[model samples]
Target: MDSAVLSGRSLSRHFSVKGAAAPVEAVRDVTLEVAPGALTALVGPDGAGKTTLLRMAAGLLAPSGGSLSVLGVDVAARPQEVQDRISYMPQRFGLYEDLSVQENMDLYADLHGVPADVRRERFERLLHMTDLARFTSRPAGKLSGGMKQKLGLACTLVRLPELLLLDEPTVGVDPLSRRELWEIVRQLVEQERLSVIVSTSYMDEAERCQQVFVMHQGRLLAAGAPADLRSRAEGLSFTAVPRTGNSARTLQARLLDARDVVVDAVPEGGHVRFIRRPDASDGAVAQLLDGLPVNPVPARLEDGFMMLLRAAPPPPTLPTLPTSPTLPASPALTPPAASKPARAAGPAGGADSMIEVRDLVRKFGDFTAVASTSFSVARGEIFGLLGPNGAGKTTTFRMLCGLLPASSGFLQVAGVNLRHARAQARAKVGYVSQKFALYGNLTVRENLDFFGGAYGLYGQRLEQRTSQVLEEFQLGGQEHMPSGQLPGGFKQRLAMATGLLHEPEVLFLDEPTSGADPLARREFWRRITTLSEQGVTVVVTTHFMEEAEYCDRIVIQDAGKVLAIGTPREVRKQADDAGNMEDAFIRIVEQNRNGGAP
Candidate 1:
């Protein structure tokens, strides 16, 4: 019995464009095998060719060289035959937004030629698993990001496919939603014996798979069990805590900026977690983190990821930032409601409160989007708002930024009332949305200049600001590259660079690192801590719960209501679990769902 469901031998894919000098090699010669009933994952950074490889496996993409097969059938030669036995959900699945949930499912079933007798039980089971039974009649467009993803999966599973393919299904979704989606997949794989190949940026997700494939720049770097990869970098990983008065972020920045020796560094639970090169001398490693408390910790999939990335070419070079930076506000960058910077007394206790919300409420007709949410953030603080997608995190942020009106509550930002002095509040803050909001057709330099000019910078001021951001984000040579063509990690950096061009008092990042790789995440947060230390208030929303550990304080929301608010340690103590952010988060959310509070 040859139990392998998918196998590729010297498989390669390439694209030729009219204007390009070199043809794009999306997938190079690669050999791999996925067994039946196995959960296999392809993990890598943005533009690493995960999607292209998945397409080739699905038969939607024809390999320019070599050969591939699915379930013993040649995919390239008999795509339609192979397609009939598999389900593939691309990165951006095409679902009819105007149709009702039930309608969309029915349409997909018709396309797949699923018989009526099989539809009854299949539809019911899918609706129950996805928690969409109650929303069957609701329009697909009205669903939240998480619910939409679930619906997309349900549609793909309308018929029993021998294999399933998911491409970053949880990219922009929150932690809770991600858990639910994975649960649905795991159930099918265990019970129905369906083989699966999922491409993802999350190391945790990749660890859940039975086998993992590491991809980088269209090449397969490594393939093995999660534990095997973790063992490859075991002794090189460490968790270090800075001495009193020196923050973990400061140490992380120091280690990361020394890219010549260190591979990666990130802030985790008040400690600097990093990976040192295996070949570095004892003196070199000791001098890197002098006067720090260091301890060896067990390596994980992420450590292996960094190890492989270090062996490859270094990522784009980010410019060193100064201890202090000056950001001036201009009429173009400020929101329409906020025309001037707020210089009055801080919200509550002078500078203690940079942001304040009291009894906030937002209603959409008969349903409430946010309910009696109250929290305050002090200057120089990194505050996090986390919850399942569509749990009102965005709504709360919009009200605070004065972009959306709160039905009932008082909101203040930077010592100014958001409702009354919206423009002033806008002038005091910078925002980076979840989606890439820059001009797709414009080059990186063009986008930066446009944003700078909007911030009221002109002539030399614009030039200086653009140059600073370019260097700070390590985006020097990207000036002429089209913003749309840049990789996912680079796109995120560009968006952040544009937001920081004007330098407001506070920064708001909505899932800023959603699809970025491990190294990119470390680099992103290092700059954030530096900004917070410089007296700037920071408020961010994220799906990655581990990131919550880096914040001074965090709030969790669900069903449009506040569930818990405290430091990472405090929240974990309440859970009585293993103390990891994921464990704590699951405990808190589950307790809340069961009508209990921590």
Candidate 2:
């Protein structure tokens, strides 16, 4: 490993907490070598020390034990020199919202000592590569989520460093923007021979890297090529289709609950893709499938991840909650009432439509954020809104929720027009925001109590409901933990619990599982499917294309209008059978942007 660009021998870091009996080992006995000009990945769930490891490599955090050498330099003793040669982008990058895009880029360029000529040339190429050329004059604050991310990348690259480290770069980004960002990174790697180390929760992203390091609880669980990991799940991977009447999610839940036989279960293309535990009895396996046809499916990086996790020790606690009090809908999220209504509802959303939008338009000055979008969500449906970053999905969601006013169009929820009975209409729904908006200092129990009280739950009744939801989400044991200290999966469970406290007829989840791991994602969808079966209509917006498969119908929008809308299968067909949702989504958006098929 002498030729390795970055090498660590028994690398470890520890943090001391005031009340903890033992100092927390953020990184422990880790040994690895990263080759030059190669793309490598560190994959793990939140709180697994991925961030800590990245910080140590970038010379921002000193290791308590073991040795780390970067670019053949001792990082611990010469952190400043190491810092000058590597670019580190944390989960949250620093970008001035008040500054124009060009100004931000210029600031970074000046800081990095990029000369005038080099700055001009680099900015041109960087902006072009990031598809941000046209947006240079706009204020960074006004840019879409995806655009802001690209701009951040450009700022980092104003002057290249010897190594690039990105921490969960696409956490909350939409599917299309995610692919685009990767395209830029891939291009940089090929053209400049730059080396990159990225820590990600996405399995697909890991597959794209030359090597991956599987980490958990601050220890190196495994390391190898993607193919080697995939081989671990061979012979056990499968796709199980439901009987004529059963939905994929329902079947998936059944398998997941059968812990003795099922290893991992997810709904894909209206089918349950799962893996069986190697030691399960034949009868246990047969009973779990319930006579369904089991087709052998190729193992994936995600499958391998779950398999590896199953072999490891369980986390210190059961971190998932079955239910929690529903979080409050964001103020100003629901759009104002619709002046004109009465659109004929079809079988999908017509007269029976739980959520409806017709000829909807929202404008900001001369720019229309959402243009003439029309759709209907039938009762008990999981309706997904999909689009690239900066698309009008948020605009449409705001309008439907009555947080914003529609420029013009009819918007209805639960047969109630938002234009007029806003409060009444809002009363029928719950909302979970993309960001955790809870009071950090408060315990989970306190947050739940506060939210329940806001929903007018009080006295014994409020206590009863709060207690019930805590139990449901399996968070009763963690109720006293600080809300801010919860892991990614636990925080989401609490957020959703807060939203469901009142048991609203409709629930809105905006990127609910955006930064969650695969296990956390499966649990979220299981609850959603359960709610659908209980006759609650769910409207969700997510960047994870695979999550869309759990939806009964999905709407794809771009710029400011609906590009495609239908079942996942129908949308895929519309995109000329792109093979999968991500491909279909990209194909459809590209085609529509180019004035064609999509």
Candidate 3:
């Protein structure tokens, strides 16, 4: 404890709400130790107290019933002393939007009272490390999502504190940027001997840490090296390829529901990876699969985490949202008939191509945001659009949603040509933006009502559809709660519920699971699976490479150009038989950037 950079004992935090029955216990009797000059990770589902513990360590919040020491000093007794030696970056780092990148760094440096001589060297190194050297004069708001995160990290490091505390630093960052950020943190830990404790939702990031603390519902479930933690799931992990004529997600949903035999399940590499109950018979998982062959695979850190979470399950979340397959289709939501574009049928049981894009182009002044990209999405299929930040994924998504006009080429959604009937086409699809674009001030029900009306639903129809979605999305009780005060998972539910009120034939989701925890993400995907099974076409963009397995097919884009498009298996094969989608995606992107060199 004396040598530890930071240590806590029986830490607890509680917050009072105006209408709540009792104070919310954000953290409860948690004990932890973070080693010096090494990376430590805090990981768990949403509302797991990771952020609360980090804030307590940073002296921003006081623990209700425990002691925390930072660098051998008692944080509660002398928070100022601890604050002087540590730098804390919250999930939403305060970057002045109008300030230039260099200006933001300078502001942080000045606030920290960094010596002028030291600031110069530090700024130079950080700029080069973040690859923002050429963008120093660009306004922070003008930078891409990944670049903004990089700038926030650089700003946080302006003074080079002895300890660094980061709360979900890479929440909304793309994979390439996430890798770069980890590299920067690792370099600091190795070269500067700066100790870092970061909270992340990405299991892969936690795997890279020297120590990991798993939390659940305000308590520490386990703490150890990643390997030590992974041992808990040994011999219980397996990968089962779905039988012919079934999608990976369908199998995954089935496995996830069999709580008696399975702990967790997800689609990966065109197969379902699952964790079986230790006490279950060997044939339990096989029987669940209806005699499908199941091969045992090495357990991963994620497998262990899932096991822990299952042992201490959180509140019952949306297992599966109801899909109104029996409801009649609304005439106003029907797509206009248009000339068919010649294309092969897509997987996932779609009868016809619902989305057709050919030589699609979009430009902003002289810069092309999307350059002649082409792809097709089938009705009842889940199609993914993946790319690094600033790679034109959002721009392409906007064009498909009919929110923005394409510069040229053919584009259609739900049989309606986007160019000729943008409004009509918009009515046929539901769109959930990357950010929470709903009115935060409104109650959940109010936001639903407003959006429902905007979609042309009337008095009785609007009320009926709104009520149906509210119940199906498991947002029934939260209808009266202020949307902003809701938890992350609930906010996501509200957003998704709002998008589905009018029951559009096609749904477009842009990074819907960004910053969401494992439980929330699983629930979201389960709902998506149900929707697809009901013949609703789904188009989505995501940074989670594993999620690509859920898609019937995907298109990888970079710098406004399509690098690869195929099923996850085919894409992986193209990248030298990469073990997983993340590896395959990295290899393909790097290869293209390296001029197709192996």
Candidate 4:
């Protein structure tokens, strides 16, 4: 048998909630093994015990039962021995915010007891691999989300180890950066024969691993190669596009409610896909999608996951409340026509010239966050800013929103110079930040009221708008729940609802669906399409290439410069690989990195 770099026998972990009297089972009876030179993925939704399992493997947490061994070292009895041979990076790895990139590397190297000469070579290779040599003197906190993730990975790789544990390494990273990180991992596995176990929510990333383990409510649901699991979903899926409005949410809700007929449903672009139980027949599926349009299609890893979770028997006892609430139901709003685009009022023409940036530049002393770059966004259009992490997308976004002053270049919004009428321009735009910008302590309704009032909404008008948003987002029943208590999907809905409360002409969303499930992402875009029907213009940034399909046009950037700009189809055509945006993005960014024209 292949050597087991890490092995666990019925491992489990229990934690006590601060206010709850009982200790919650974060991980339960998980039996698994990590083989040498293999990439194993631990996947589940948030709070599904992925982190708990990884921590236990790293000897950072003591399992309540079962046995764990790291390269023959018993984790519960000889944690120090296990730690000495493993490199573990938690979700929030200790990347010193105030320290320069090189300084932070040096600190970690010292802590790991790496020799000076060896550390020099390792650090040099890491810097080159992560493409951080150019920003060696930049502070860690100043780095973009993707850059920080890369730096964190680099620091952990400062020393060679038998096992590497990465806890949700690419959770908030952009697609380009995520690809780079995966490339590095692949290279390490080949060159060092490294055994790696990474926890992630992205099925695409998980599919690339040598093996996958699906966890739910702290128990192992399934484990195998991606293809193996996908094969298990055979003859269980079908696709259906909406005839009017956002049909995905309605389809998802309908299928979910029919527990006996359909096991799981996921919404892909333009369609809602489902997976039926093994015992389900074609007629049963037809009965489930009875009133909707449907077509048979192939099953994917996501479909398998949904089916497995849906079919798993519920635990004897109820699981503890998750860190967040479940995603909201889909809205029933109609999507606007795709042909007639809304134009923002501007000097160029009608709403088509809603925003104009001439030689836009933003610099911080000797460093430039955004070099001289220019672009425009039309009203009623979904405009996407695509780039690697720390590639100036946020800087450009900040400048357009008047949140940061540009060192040079002219920026006009709604036919007025942003510099001269910052507040007026802002008033016409809705902005959802990359971070959770809502009040966690306040209920969803309260947060909406606060934002509405800030936008000058009052009394009857505010009440009417709030009710409309609540209904549209399917949050009518949970308006009283604290925003902090909502799940990742619901929180996203609340954020979008708040942004649209003022009914601004242009909406700016920064990575709006980052860290959300595929179903949640599909539903989020559905609402955006609904708003577009009402003539709301949208400018957003995202790490998911699939999400780009929803956009009317996209702008690609790298290192503070524009690389490509066009419709999704047009931009994709520039790729040598044909239709794969992920491949296309990597090719474009890599070419630019090597000083080649996109």
Candidate 5:
């Protein structure tokens, strides 16, 4: 520990708020160490103190109580010296939008006080490493999400220091971009012998690190190598194939609701992988599975992470289904008997098509954002639209929601012709954009009232609906609080509540769980499953490839073109039975990019 690159002993941070009863303890009695020339990850949910610890190490924020040393210097007493020896890239890396890529790099270099003689070689190497050399003259605003992240990274490296700190570097980017950014960081650690400490929401990303520190509720839950953590769930992980009548999502929801016998559940490869409570007996686990065939699967880092989180009680802020029986049938979520059949190439069962598109196209000046795409969604199906950044998924989503006009093609939603009745179609669908669009200054109820009025509800009807969702989404107690002051999970719940106030037949979600932790994501999907079961069609877009398994069918697009479309299993088969959805997605996109098909 004496040779540690950075270390903290009993680090803690607390903040006082104006109307709060006590100080918000952002970090409490925590201790950790980062090794030199190796990758280390701080894994946690929102409000878990990861950012606070990083800021303390960077000398941007002082710890309330503790001793911290960086590069053998006491950071608390000599902040300037430690600040000069480390590079910190926060969640939002500052970049001038109007500046060219080269100009942005120069700005960082100038700020870092790099010598003129060292600029040329460093800039060239950084740009090439980021694969942004060709776009050096392009304005930063014109870059895609992934490209902008790469540029941000390049700027962060204009002058390499003793250590690197990255906070959720891959949060909003696509799978392809996430992979590329990790490659750049790995090369820096392996070749340049750099010391790194990154905080991330992706469990798979944490698995890539040599050591991981898991934090929750401002405290360190555990810290060790990824393999050592995986061992914690060794005997408790299992995958269950749903019975003939149920979908993987439906079955996963049932398991998740069984809190006494199940700790976590997620859809994967046409099956539901779940973790049984350590104290639950074999009979209890079987009853929760509802007679489905089950088999043991190797425990993943995520399983261990989930198990660690279960030690802490979940926030009672999200809705849950009744726990009466195995996969308890909620009157709101169970599809009717007549339309219960699901098809691989078309809508679920023989249900009527709720969304249809043919030869759809969107053009931005001379560029085609969407090129000749076709698809259909059943009345109660969960359909996923997936693609890399700038692949036109948003353009396609906008057209479906009636927010943007398609350049050419036929479009229909809820039996309303988009071209002729775009306004009417809009009334039948609820839309949640990638970012939270509600007014943060307003209280939860006030924001809901404003959006409800905009949706044409008023008087008693608006009041009734507002109260209904307040209880349904578990936001009743916090109704009078300012929306901005709510926690990350509560904010997301409010967003979804607003979208559902009008009772739209179809719901549109764009990367809804982009940076949410695994626990929050599980709860979010559980609610979505309930909505679909209630005959409301759900159309979603996400960068989490594993989430694609929840969709009845998915369409993958690249370069504004559809590359593949089918159920998760069918899509995997198209990729020659790739191990998982992520692998299948990468294979399909890489094959198409390389002028071939899998």
Candidate 6:
């Protein structure tokens, strides 16, 4: 038998909510094993207890019941022993924001008691491997989202631990960074016989693992290779593209409602793909797709997950809140208009230019986050900025939004120079940050109202705008709930609602759908399309390459440079031999990493 690096028997964790009567079972009766040198994935949705299970395996959290052992040490009884042999990266690992990249590495190395000579060698290799040498002196907090993720990974890798436990390390990281992180893992597993247990929400990432464990509501639903889980979904999947007036969102919702027959439904590009319940008959599936263009297709991991979730009855729905008296019944809320001056022409046809950026640069002392990059965003288009973590997408975004001033370059928003007119440029664009930016203590309605007022809206107009936005974003019923108390999906909707409260000509979303479910993503895109119909130009970044298909055009960046730019179809063509976007992305990034043209 293969060596069991870590094993858990009937492991469970419970947390007591401050006000709740009963303890919340974060993880329940979970049993699993991580074999030496094997890549095992713990997959689940938000709050599904993936983190809890990983923590227990890492000896960071003691299980309320059952037992766990790391290597030969009993974690429950010998946590320090397990800690000495394993590297555990919690969901929010402490990365010193004030320290420079090299300083952070040195600090972690010192903490791990790595010898000075060995630490020097390891740090040098890591800096080169992560391509962070150029930014060695830059503060960790000052780095872009992707850069921070890379730094965090680098800090953990300073010491050669026998086991590595990472809890959603790539949650908000970009594709390039994600690929690099995985490559490092693959190499470590092969070279050192390292045992790794990582929790991730991305199915593609999970598919790369040798073994996958599916968890939901603190229970293990399935465990096997990706192929094995996919095989179980055979003969149940069918694909259908949008026809006539039916949108993907409409089709998905309709299919989801048929829960008894259709086990799962997901939107891939322009089509709705689904899996039928095992007990569902052929005729029943046919009936479900009656009048729609449907074809048999292979099943995917996501399809399998949806099938499993639908097969088992759903957990009880949370109780609804009382209606708010402040919100009026009629007309609803209408978001404030854009604060910036309106452009002479609508997005469809501007003076041949929508956003012109020339020789744009953002630098921090000796470190340059974005090194003289240039790009343009067309009017009435969905433009995507793609790259690995720390690729400078966020830096470029901040400069575009006038949140961060460019060190040098000619930057224009809606044909107006931002350096000369910062407020005007900012007013013309709506930005949804990667992090939750809304007031957590404020109700959804209050958050929207505050944002709208910031844009100079007032009185009944502000109230009307808030109502309209709430309804448009599907948060009409949850208006009174505090934004902080909402789930991942609802929180995303609330943030988006606030961003769009003022009708800006351009919408900027930084990983807006990060940590969101497939269903929520589809819904969010539907709203994006609705806004696009009204001629709102969208500039966004996402870790999910599949979501890139929704964009009219995309730009891939690396090492502070634009690598590729084209329509989704065009970019896929660039992959040529690689086939899909995921494959193309890997190919492009690997070539760039190896010092070739991206």
10 residues in a row with least lDDT, candidate 6: 327-336
RMSD in angstroms, all models?
A: 5.7, 5.8, 5.2, 5.8, 4.6, 5.4
> Cα miss at 317, model 6 (Å)?
4.8
lDDT of 3 by residue, 270-351 (tens): 8899999998876876688888878999999999998888888555432221332232222221121111122322553334
- Give the Cα error of residue 214 in candidate 2, in Å: 0.6
Residue 1, model 2: lDDT of: 81
Residue 108 Cα positional deviation in candidate 6, in Å, after optimal superposition: 2.6
What overall lDDT goes with each candidate model? 0.82, 0.83, 0.86, 0.78, 0.86, 0.76
Q: Write the per-residue lDDT of candidate 6 for residues 155-238, one digit (tens) a residue.
A: 998998888888888878767667777887787788777888888878877888899898877888899998888787888888
lDDT score, candidate 5: 0.86
The Cα RMSD of model 2 versus the native structure comes to 5.8
Q: Can you list the residue pairs that collide in candidate 5?
A: 333-533, 341-349, 342-349
Full ranking by lDDT: 5, 3, 2, 1, 4, 6
Instruction: Write down the lDDT that model 6 would get.
Output: 0.76
The list of candidate 3 runs beyond 4 A from truth reads 316-351
Candidate 2 lDDT: 0.83
Cα lDDT, model 2, residue 442: 86
TM-score of each: 0.89, 0.91, 0.92, 0.79, 0.93, 0.78
Cand. 4 Cα-lDDT = 0.78
Candidate 4 global TM-score: 0.79
Write the number of the candidate with greater TM-score, choosing between 1 and 3: 3
- Clashes (N, CA, C under 3 Å) per candidate: 9, 31, 0, 5, 3, 13
**Candidate 6 runs further than 4 Å off:** 1-10, 16-23, 65-69, 72-78, 97-103, 114-151, 157-159, 237-297, 315-380, 406-419, 441-446, 467-486, 517-520, 559-561, 586-598
Cα lDDT tens digits for candidate 4, 302-371? 8787767666665333222344234444445543222334432222224467788879888888888788
Candidate 2 residue-wise lDDT at 93:
94
Cα lDDT for residue 240, candidate 5: 95
